[model samples]
Target: CELSSNASVSPGNFILHPSCDYDGLIPSVVFFLSFLLGVPGNIAVIIFRPNFQHLSSVSQKLMLNLVVSDLLCLLTLPLWIYAFLYMWTFGLVACKLLTFFVYCSTYGSGLTVTVLSVQRYLLVVHQKNWTHQMGVRLLLVLLWLFSIILSIPQLVFRQVTTLQNKTLCQSQYSSQAQRITVLLVEGLVGFTIFFLVVFSYTRLQKKVKQAAFFNNPQTTRLVTCIITSVFIFWVPYHFFDVLSAAAIFLNNEDLLQFCLTALYTVKALHAVNSCLNPLLYAFTSHNLCCKKSLSPKI
Candidate 1:
């Protein structure tokens, strides 16, 4: 979804009306703060890479990619804030380019989490093997390639249009069918991958509890927090997107407006995940290191 310009009085059929005229101001301020927090947090993760080297190769790589993806998404927020504050004065090409990057990064981060969950599942359920490491490397490459391919549609559909004497950047679908198709694709891909991640983690948790072997409370708690954080941060965004798309498909203006308003609020909440992730990492590292030091060598 794209950010709408504040100057546009009418919310349009696809857009939702905010409860107040200055609703955009709240989100803009939130986005600006998120950028300030997320950039530094993610950069710190990159700079402190050696501290995380104790994590498995796959886990380390996935965490790094996740940070990079979040950073890419966060980098586009300043542009979005500008659009929300004034208008999309960056012209057509910049609009498409920035939108493309945002979608790419969003998808990339989601897929990375899915892969990370699977890696953790494998580590707990199966014996370590060289082949698993090789497979993970290959999967990482495929995940990024798929994310880029999925994001190409955004570049094709997004346009900068003049509305109420203000230029706005948004997805300009030619038909409702086109919009539905895009929304369904995005929702399905994100939900499907996240579902699999949750399933894998659930099963892993069950197996770990059943065996009662190598069951570190700190590790278990950290994993639970990570999974919970992912769900809390992303589920609402996807749920609201699906609801908004359904409203559009049914031509329910009232429902569409409500969903859009809710979406506008949830979108900032979704972006907060990037800022929260670094803190999660810090907790995970500290807990795991302490666990390692205390555990008996078998």
Candidate 2:
């Protein structure tokens, strides 16, 4: 609760320094909105099975996996939103578990998107069907396994401590090196996925441009919009994360403060991105939209 000039933040210690005030009015609202839209949107896709016809069955399965991960992020929003607006009344165990699941789910979603894009590219451009029915399951297993591995740091470091009589849930770093190391690891993994998605789509676009018989159902607009939202919404989250690492490495308190503050905006953007795809797919799918056109008056 109290900030001291020389605080020891070692494990089992309770005096961890708080990051800047990330929980503000605007970010809290954004978290609430993301929860409102994302929960229903993802659930709709699951119940209705909105299909993107251009994607192969393999890609569709990957998408289903993605929806689960998105739901994980959305489901945790209420806890985070409440903590922002009020306080993290949940105990340290809850804080650790919640943050761990969040890190896992966010990483899982990013990896899923990257894999989906790459699978699409390979199917479209190179005609490479590397994974069939059985392989996909194994891929999913490995994906989550990696996600859990990466999320362990969050579980280990995330703690619940009070600030000004209001409980806060945040990661605690014992040393400057520890903070930088964690952020760098997270940033590298995230941006690596981002670059993979970009590369996959870039190749897809190039190959499509050169193909003479590229006249399919034209899912280009739909797919492009999804990828665009990923970059538009998720890229800043990772960018600022990396910048925060840099700021810490350089010991620039002002820069570190600025990057941490900017995270509030990018977090909102990322939450919106989580829900955007469902609206895109649920509304855009021709088969799904036209299915009920012939219904008699109920």
Candidate 3:
């Protein structure tokens, strides 16, 4: 909506426009860490999923998909860091492609986790025969399909632009209205899925207080860890986007620019989520020798 940050604005009083200190090192280190953890973690999950007889459950397959998505997203981080440092040296097409892959993997991971939650709900609440209906193959197919569809907009809207002799990869929405539409849709979808997961977990907890299977500490821990990771990593970023969208509508340039830059940090943090997922979700299981055993599948 407002012009890009590179757009000219008359230099006002220096006192009025104090320089904001942005810690560039934090992002560079974080991105490096993410790439380090995400690659091997996702690979291990993928490799062990079929080979490990203990964790060969249907639910584990979805977890593998989540790890794979995280890894894919993480694999692009070096380029992201380079882009941030060198201001998107990769040309227009490469910029678009990289941005597209990033969004596709991130959104795919989000949707996969949401689907896992819904599957858990179905299994625990209705106790239905969903495993046969939506096995790993079917779920994997749908996962890729949904990811591609949701990612189309990124491909359509992203562009590479030169600013002060440095290129930057950015979304190039044709209209503010379309951008708002996309944000609204993403918000609604995220909220809906989040709500369903929390509600289902609440109901599940209430019913299983004394049951041995229900009281399994590992199951509770796993769910708590995953939920916490998602909330901590995503909630701030999503809320920031909401504020950015609202600011755009209000036509507040200064506030919107500040918010966008701040959201850039949050976006980088969100990228870190994929890296953390493997640590929070899979690392403990493997270490405890629990990866091979399905004590309780969440």
Give RMSD to native, each candidate: 4.8, 6.8, 6.3
Between 1 and 2, whose lDDT is larger? 1
Query: Candidate 2 on 23-105: residue-level lDDT in tens?
Result: 35677687788889898999888887765564456766887888888888888877776666676788999888877787788
Best lDDT goes to which candidate?
1
- Residue 150 CA displacement from its true place in model 2, Å: 1.0
> TM-scores for all candidates?
0.84, 0.84, 0.81
Candidate 2 backbone overlaps, count: 0
Ranking, TM-score, top scorer first: 1, 2, 3
TM-score of 1: 0.84
Which residue pairs come into collision in candidate 3? none
Model 1: per-residue Cα lDDT over 57-118, one tens digit each: 66777888988988888887887777666767888898778777777788888888787677
Off by over 4 Å in 2: 1-23, 52-54, 212-220, 280-298
> Residue pairs in steric clash, candidate 1?
none
* Alpha-carbon deviation at 252 in model 1, angstroms: 1.6
Question: Once superposed on the true structure, which residue ranges of model 3 sit more than 4 Å away at CA?
Answer: 1-23, 50-56, 133-136, 213-217, 283-298
Q: Provide the clashing-pair count of each candidate structure.
A: 0, 0, 0
Sliding window of 10 residues with minimal summed lDDT for model 3: 9-18
